[model samples]
Target: MGAWSRLKEAFTREANISSPEDLLAQARGMRNGKVPVTKDTALRNSAVWACLRLRADLMSSFPIDVYRYVNGIQIEVPKPPVLVSPGGTEVGMREWMYSTEFDLDRGGNCFGVITERSGVIGPDGRGLPGRIELVELGAVAIRGNGSTITKFIINGAEYDPWEVWHEKQYTVAGVPLGLSPVAYAAWVIEETLSAQQFARDWFAGGAVPLAELKNNAKVVNAKDARVARDQFRAAVDDSGLFVHGMDWEYKPIQAVASQSAFIEARQYGASEIARFFGCPGDLIDVAVSGSSITYASMTQRNLQFLIMNLGPAVGRREDAFSRRLVSGPRFVKFNTDALLRMDPEARARTIGARITNRTLAPSEARALDNLPPFTEDQLSEFDRLFGSRSVPAQPTTAVPGATP
Candidate 1:
């Protein structure tokens, strides 16, 4: 078969697997073809670090809350069991979110074991899964194909699909497993690693200095070459001098292009990786010079991030949690306001605008500021101080004409 025909056949074969074991075997075979990029090595790339950190940290910082719908309005309930103590130990909601997001970003999948639950009570009651334990992606395996997940294998133990929670990123048709960004972008990451290694090795090897012996002489054997190399190293190391015949020459290999070329290559790699992960290049410290994109303020940038990057992911999580943890009318939500919090000045401006438009009440604004509503005495004082100024005086046109 021609190369193109073989490539088409491989894709067709992968897309035709209908058995659970066949899907698992295909995933394992693909994984075995290359050294899987571990979380540690992936983080060494600045782009990966920036992308994962920004996403995980921001998502984790948000408050995960449970609420119930009543009369078409949502009311937040007291801390739900899932949100109050997700991992059962020191790991709470924030840590749970962080770990899940980290896994999703690194491995395109997040797995957690749901342990313990309580009978469904009133809308205000706590949600199910009294305790949840995060499972490392490396330790989890998909055991079925198609929409129905039969089981999950964690640490060599088989778990019913319903017993575990799973979140996945990009998925291909006929594949039940999530597709990892690192695996898809392996070539770019490898190039970046190689470039960094080259630079390090270059510096470690005395910056590429070359030496020529007198009269074009050459070492006759490996032992002679070793002795000559040691002598050269000794002279250079001890006195920064090379004792040689008058005809000896020393030269250094200079890069054809400026060092900036290497820097540009690395920068390009970072941008490529950021694109692969659906992150803005600038968020990962990839310079955005000469770009048309601009943000009027930090608030605008955050809003853009929410709409363009995190909106879908947040929706998926909310749906998953609602289906698994809550009963009718009750739903799980992450308070994204926590992530979009503004500076004091910006916050004040927003609140002021809302109040002026009468869309928000003064008491509600005060509550948002963590302050109690004004007491009757305080209200009276406020009236005394500013109420008179707000009330306009009656017009005195006749009196003004008489005075003129």
Candidate 2:
């Protein structure tokens, strides 16, 4: 085959679909309230919600990977874009971007296009940021012959012009592996899970224990804090085979913007946390110049405490991503400023005390030293807060029936 022929194989959409009988069975199940109810359906519902409000917002569009975080974990799978009608017109498959932003003063153009996942959620509890969807009347694949195909996906299945040629073998340069959405999702999920597991293990003292901490006290300067975060994040990257952070930041804005507390924290703190934890990237400052930088938002007070406490131990947690989606920095600034707002004398006294004492109080030191190792229980709130005993109730969602 020529290069053009090879290109055709890799650049087309394909899927496994239910037959007429299968469709009828599914519809009947729906009517009977017995539709299998797999995680896939829940995910699809979540994805749909994320893409709903993209009618005309610009800047960052939703990517398909937005639906990756389901069930208290970051899922890294990709799904076909859910093309939809912006004006509710019946244009079958046309061209469209995921979001557009307009101001009477600024003029409206499409700003966000959902291409790949990056960790935002939809209103219905699905990750929506970094998601890309086909416009309601969108044409996805255009051939050199001036022909185009309409594409859409649901429940990890894709639909397109390729459906007519489903039986044809898909090959590229003598490689004959065909394309299918389920296969893609499976591969992506497996890879994502592996990386996540690796991150969890690496941070739990499995990588390199800071021997100095065992002998001396845990010393933390501003620079030391930065380095400690980086070292922990490095363990996460050592896996070398998994992907992360694609939709970690994008989903909540368009999909589930209601997470006010989480939204603030992520904008202020999570990014910093990600950086502090070892992102090896530029330090994202909470305050740049004078006013607080909006992007450096923070999570709720209690949640921030938990994340700061556990992050060095747990490589990554699903809650971090969700909270990050809606985070902003105002609340954190208030809390921080309030504490330091003490009178100059009190401030001097505090500073003098710290300068004089080389160590923390016994209780404070014990609290720091007794921090637990990473355990599935620690990840799940059902575990104890202090001791290794069991706790009541599984981790439930803030909203009932939210994608867990």
Best by TM-score: 1
Q: Using Cα atoms with residue i matched to residue i, what is each candidate's TM-score against the true structure?
A: 0.81, 0.17
Per-residue lDDT of 1-404 in model 2, one digit per residue for the tens?
44344334433434332222122334333321322322133223222122222211211232212234467654333332332332234321123322221110011111123344335444445544443332311112222221123443333345543221111112224222222212222222233333344444545646434223211344457787566546545755896432334322211113133235333533443233223222211222333334442332233432343344323212221232233333221010001232113445654555446534833232232232343333455546544465544432322322211110
Each model's C-alpha lDDT? 0.68, 0.30
User: What tens-digit string does per-residue lDDT give for candidate 1 at 127-190?
Assistant: 3566778977667764443444566778878787657877777665544556677766766776
Position 53, candidate 2: lDDT: 22
- In angstroms, give how far residue 343 of model 2 lies from its true place: 36
As a whole number from 0 to 100, the lDDT of residue 310 in candidate 2 is 27
